[model samples]
Target: MISKSKVTAKLSVIDRFLPLWIFVAMGLGVALGRVYPAIGPALDAVKVGGVSLPIAIGLFWMMYPVLAKVRYGKLQSVSANGKLFGASLAFNWILGPILMFALAWLLLPDQPHYRTGLILIGLARCIAMVLIWNMLAKGSGEVAALLVALNSVFQILCYSVMGWFFITVVPTWLGAESTEFHVSMWEIAKSVLLFLGLPLVAGALTRVGFVRSRGEEWYEKKFLPKVGPAALLGLLYTIVLMFAMQGDKIVSLPFDVLRIALPLVLYFGIMFTSAFLLSKKLGFSYQETASLSFTAAGNNFELAIAVAIGLFGISSGEALAGVVGPLIEVPALLALVYLSLWLKDRLFPADVRANETAEPKDQATSLAQGGQLR
Candidate 1:
């Protein structure tokens, strides 16, 4: 088994200090917003097709690099694992939404707006950040990419219907007051298309184009390293902008934020732990298990925040809850990354050979050698 110190040493400086960097970004964002309140308004004023321009840029920049690292050629191999697909679908769609709804109402019964916001988050399965988390956890990039793409398709199709049901219909079934929530399908579609579709196409095209022209050797070795660091940079950039825009709310409403954060924390913990255990139980390798866990644990906070802001207004508790999703998720998932590695050493030791067989050597080695796995 790889020692803890050895695994830690294998991570790049950026990966090693990811939590520290994210916290620093959050602090810097809060400071920027606190010092320059107008910054938020100015940023809000510049919209790209009704989405904040800065945020759109950050999301694109953040997702593109990670997506570019996906081994699209190996997708068939990942997809052939029907068990993995079915299990992922069940965890992300069925268990995930129900769990979040239970947590939201159970934890924040008094805060309807916040409860609704959390439900929206639950409906929006992750597309973007799962790749980064999967990569960091030394999971299968191919599986991560495929699962993310699958979730995006599901997100585009079911998000609105599920949002209405969870926030509106389910409450009445449970003898509570049903909230009236309406969201435009086009809006959800637009967000998915822009945030997920654009980067995905770019990434796939880049891989296909580069690998075909430059040969696999040059593309993996020379090109990927240049692009790998950008994923971290864009992630930090997105976090800063997100926090900066809502820094006032986060700073002033500490107690309320904490109230909203509690359910989200519970949601992430339960989702990740359950997924990890179930995946392992199902006989998946550590790599596939990590991919499934992160995908199951993460949410499309961008979509949740946008929908909440549009429907409930930026200053509403719903929006505040949506904003808090990533604040909690970033740290929560980072902790899970380490937890996954630790678990790998203990629970997944027997499956190491399976994982090595499932994953390409260069891909697995890249994580230890400062290259992003593809």
Candidate 2:
């Protein structure tokens, strides 16, 4: 059995480096965009048979380690945490999109495609990054894993619904042409399966094999450490290609970043605040509340970007918004992680302090007693 203290220590090391890894990836992505436009287009060759697909290479690798560690049985554990589950579902599905729509309308520039792109990005909730947040907050790994699975399901089902609503319904509300709002459900489903589903399945299988063959301890100590850097590198490589492909558009539309940044900031602020309040009212401990808050705040840019490219083409301002979302999100999330630590210290001070020195036998005895009660 993995002790909480050991898990906490390992997470501290990961927390120290995760922000840097994400920023490095973003920088590399930008550099790649600047250097090789054609190379960016070439990287999209991964497809099912001959049909071209929209897979985010970096996102896939980044999620691999987390998926590998997922205990399949944990899915069943979610029922025990219904309030937390309800809170995540409410924020991600209910409040999340509404806030995104409002943010896009209020903050994103007047450009139509760019506005749509921000909406798409916001509609997709964070699947992988939230896990990192949960880990940093010392949340239940089981709850985090369940959220990943739940978000993956919602991303596929709701992407088309939310996309069409934004494109069609929102335009009508603003007295624009609803007739021109066009995105096929088939295309959205295919993109979700190819980019999101494939990586998820691959990661799950990898996790199962690693646990069975090498055992959890070996997998945790040896394999898990390496997965983080590898995923970050993959994301960086993919981001570079994306930036390279869209470098010209990015440079030409200098204010695009400013425009995109607004909706993102608004969305993050609204979602984080809402989740934090709900967690408190629901009486969640500080750690769990932090996990809920960040999970609500983060967006799943990888899925959103893929769908944006598929729907609006890679050069569309919409796709650019999707790309920019992560650039803003990474640093913001790091800040939130620190904020979570601070909040945890204030509200639940016990979480931050080092454990008192205790003999191994005594610790084992305590754990055994607790297990017997359960």
Candidate 3:
């Protein structure tokens, strides 16, 4: 088995530079689109239900590695940290959505498409990347694993339904006439079925098949590394195609991207701070708080981008807003990871009776055992 130090070292390079890589890919995509105009659209024509087929393939790759790591069967572990679980659920589902909706409405009143994009992003919480962020912050891997598993399941269940309501029904209720463009509930369901359903099933099968056959250790440390940066690879591929189709907009109104990013930045910062404070108030341990904070803060940009393109077309403002989510989120999350660590030292000192034992319990110890301070 690999040591924790080795795992950290291995992941550091990719995690640290993810934002830089995304921006580089974005620029490359814009450049290619501007330079080779015909190639971008020809690829766009290869679509089934508004999403570019090429982009969908990349989206699958982006989503698959994330889904593969989730252990939906481990939900029994959830009762071990009911407080942690409840706080996370309340923040992610209740407060997070309302906050982002307010931000989108207050900030982008004039840009209805951008408002819709941000709302979609808000409805879809982070299922995959928060695991990495939680690990980087020295949070409990077990708690992080549980949070991610819960989020993944919740995402599949609620994303399409909440999405249909918010993206379609809620907007009209709020008196946003721009939704008159007419997106059917069937269309939204189809998009969800394609974007999230396929990768989710594929990842589940791969996880069960590999673990039952090769044992969990080899399936995780060995097989997982072999699929390094699957998220980034898929992200870069889709970014290239997305920008390829939207080159003209990038060239003409570069600042518009910044407008889309504004609400996202606010969303991340607000969620992180609110969750952090709530964790502290609830007397959670440093690591537990870190996991909770990151869970509440991070996003599932892969699903957002895929659904954006599928629902709004590859070149729509919605897709661009979805793309900018990661551009801002990567650096924002990296910075927050550091902040969480620093806070562990100062804001919430490690004085738990459990840790004073000088003999740490197993990583997966339940909260009832006083393990890792749920």
Candidate 2 residue-wise lDDT at 30: 64
Worst 10 residues of 1 by lDDT: 365-374
After the best TM-score superposition of candidate 1, give how far the Cα of residue 58 lies from its true spot, in angstroms.
1.1
lDDT of 1 by residue, 1-374 (tens): 33446555656777667789999999999899999999898888887635689989998998888888888989997899999999999999999999999998889888888998899899989988777788778788889888887997888788888888888888999898887788777887788788888998998999999999999889888898888788888989988998888898889999998998898888899999999999989999888999999999999898888889888898888899998899899989988888887898699876655555665433324342232322
Clashing pairs in 3: none
* Candidates sorted on lDDT, descending: 1, 3, 2
Q: Is candidate 2 or candidate 3 better by TM-score?
A: 2
- Tell me the spans in candidate 2 whose CA falls farther than 4 Å from its real position: 1-18, 45-55, 182-218, 221-229, 232-239, 353-374
Q: Supply candidate 1's per-residue lDDT for 102.
A: 92
TM-score of each: 0.92, 0.79, 0.70
Best prediction by TM-score? 1
lDDT of 2 by residue, 1-374 (tens): 34656533434332435566666666666666667666555756665411223335455665565555556666675557888888899998888888888777777536778888888877778776666556545555556667756776777677677777877887798886552445555655654565556666887787778889998888655676656455445544554555655555666676878788877876787788778877877888765687678878988776677677766777888888887887678777767766665666576655434222333323222110111000
